[model samples]
Target: MVVGEFTQDVDVVVIGAGPGGYVAAIRAAQLGKKVVVVEKDEVGGVCLNRGCIPSKALISAAHHYEIMTHASNIGIQAEGISIDYGKVQEWKESVVKKLTDGVSSLFKGNKVERVKGEAIFVNEKEIRVVSGYEGSRYRFNHCIIATGSRPIELKPFPYGGRIISSTEALSLKEIPKTMMVIGGGYIGIELGQTYAKLGTKVTVIEGLDSILPGFEAEMSRLVTRNLKKLGVEVYTNAMAKEAKQTDHDITVTFTTRNNEEKQITADYVLVTVGRRPNTDEIGLDAINMKMTDKGLIEIDHQCKTSVPNVYAIGDIVPGPALAHKASYEGKVAAETIAGHPSAIDYKAIPAVVFSDPEIASVGLNETEAKEQGLKVITGKFPYAANGRSLSMNAGDAGFVKLVANQETGLLLGGQVVGPEASNLIAEIGLAIEMGATLEDIALTIHAHPTLGEMVMEAAEGALGQAIHQINRQIK
Candidate 1:
């Protein structure tokens, strides 16, 4: 030990001030533990600062602009509608500042000390946090790692000036006249569609057979149809070979599904393949921490790592790289550290894609149930048959689908593709979480002329008692 240096001791030290880390710090503090958070960048991490919040702001702006430009069909007229993208970005930044500031306020209220530095493990019991020329060590009784993950960079498409990642895509100074998107996962699709609605000529290249491969084919197809309506081009089973950037534009070359070569030019190319866990640089090898072959830290239900006192959550652990999921695990890890029997339950983790009309799902869909050898029954109700959807001009857009055990009528899962899908999926998530059955959802009377009624209607259809749509009689 240095003569002038002293090690700071805390009851809990959390790495990364993102959704997972900060939440863990607050929960631990609430449970009477001295907490310290080590963050390399901004306090809110990528989700609030660069990813989720900012992108959603832009998506909302684009959606409003699209609606205003085409309101004539709804017995209303909007004229001379234009978007000042500069103002849009400023407003988006304001929204981000408010949320990040709120998180910081919560930290201060909870008395969690935040250290702005990069944290590296010194051993199983201590860590060195370095900020520029200064460095400090923290000895913690327990540690929670919520380091999260980073966007995966592809070899063929190294990010630079014109080839940008989502982090850069969200902060662009000006909206491009044309944009090329690589990878058609949720991130790419969301951003691509946002720009498309904003009047940018957008092209999407997906390596798989379909975009949003994690979602149901029917649901994703609706998004694909909407993309075409927005004048966006989509290519599936396509490989992005290379990119050539000029001062004014970027030219991307790729091979089609049939092995034919093609090229497209755009102002910028956005890459959103996936995210990799931020586990490499934190010096996990020093503590001999266990991880998967893919570099994900191994954690049990309590988010406890192999070293009992050290824990990991969020993108570093096995599960979807979602902010809410990380936040949930953060609380569970904090409770477990406080000697509570808290554990993780992943049965009802809802995933939502904010594309045009949105797509949301929770638990097992029909295909998944059938693959697992469970006798399943499915019911679907189109948005067109719902009065609220018709009144809202979304009648031809999407539908609600429900999946359940045929024998027991227990709700297994639900998928929604339409307006307010993100909000509507929560009911299904709660249903699955509480072990609610089809009859439970159907028997609960939903208010008339509301999108929520579709849930009840879908449930009723599954039981052969649908009112708005034709029912399927169980033999």
Candidate 2:
């Protein structure tokens, strides 16, 4: 169709085929709305193809290799453990293909139309989708914008051949012999440690005093210690200034916190400073949607935008730029559009980092509760005392800490840093969401010789009845 020559009308139009967009489209369809989703590139968005899924696949392979090579501690010896980068790449791609195909099948099953194109808002109720040399106008009863975000390109280190972004890092056929990571956040820590396990020398540079700044200091210390064990050098309070790249190598210049300038050479520098919301060039100005200076869309509890009948979710809105968070908001927005009374309840949004000795947390921490002037009690237990953790030969170091109300024993928050932390956090997340108290978790019987038993033990410690550890009596 030529520009404005034909108009496709729909009950609801979702302006991105990412996680949030596709979920919103299917949900709208389930609510008896004819929905159409537009995407400029892949259907599964950054999470499926680049950000979450692919990186995790690589991390899994790296972790398996690391554990298999060190099996001598369990009297299991392997002659050699090596990673075939090509095979690893293929496996990662297979994982992505399976997921993206599932998302496509979901759209088909839900009768939601998928359009491949970049959509620019023509007005409040209309959009012009441009794909190649062709264009079409879409008019809808309501619109849900889930355009997502992109990696922020630092001026000092523009991404290219030698200075690459996380997207490019995940796709390398042969892992670089040496790599420099320019951020200490989850992305930098995960990938940097991954390559280290794959026989690459990795160095991480961070502007803050510590890497993984969002995590608690104690949790970060555990990760930092393990990163150092992998021989990944971390330079905190260091600022990356510039990169001079040749065909085969690059020298990166950075300044230390004490105003000391330094330089290091590496095959590639992976920059993961942060992400920027993709709210520009879509003609958001056409509807004058209220947005923050950094391009985050402002929305109500149901994700309703300033303009009527328009909603925005995912990375384009405030809150953590997490795939699960976006999906949650997508559901809320779809429900609100369908005239349902759905609102966001972020009582227990869990954040997990797949670093060495993985870190995960949900709800309030001791610092957060203290900041909010809430009197709380905390109980902690270590993996060293857990039978399951010791049996698996992962009992060296790690802990689970639970926070609860001082007066009522109501669970306030929980943090885990150890083996299977990602999976273990789910139980506590459900506990917090269901408003279960510390006693509830304490009395619930967890399976014997299972990692989940730590949850109950931690809860018991909170109630001053812990059998696994010496309990400090607290009423």
The most accurate candidate by lDDT is 1
Give one digit per residue, the lDDT tens place, for model 1 in 1-475.
2223358989999999999999999999999999999999998998999989999999999999988888998978878888899999999999999999999999999999999888999999999988877788999999999998999999988889899999999989998999999999999999999999988999999999999988889999999999999999999999999999999999999999999999999999999999999999999999999999999999988999999899999999998999999999999999999999999999899999999879999999888999999999888999999999999998997999999999999999999999999999999999999999999999999999899999999999999999887777776
Instruction: Give the least accurate 10-residue stretch of model 1, judged by summed lDDT.
Output: 1-10
Model 1, residue 63: what's the lDDT?
94
lDDT per residue for candidate 2 within 33-152, as digits (tens), equals 999999999999999999899999999999899889988878998986777889999999999999999999999999999999899998999999999878888999999999999999
Candidate 2: regions farther than 4 A off: 1-4
Alpha-carbon deviation at 3 in model 1, angstroms: 12
In model 1, residue pairs whose N, Cα or C atoms come closer than 3 Å (at least 3 residues apart or on different chains), thus clashing, are none
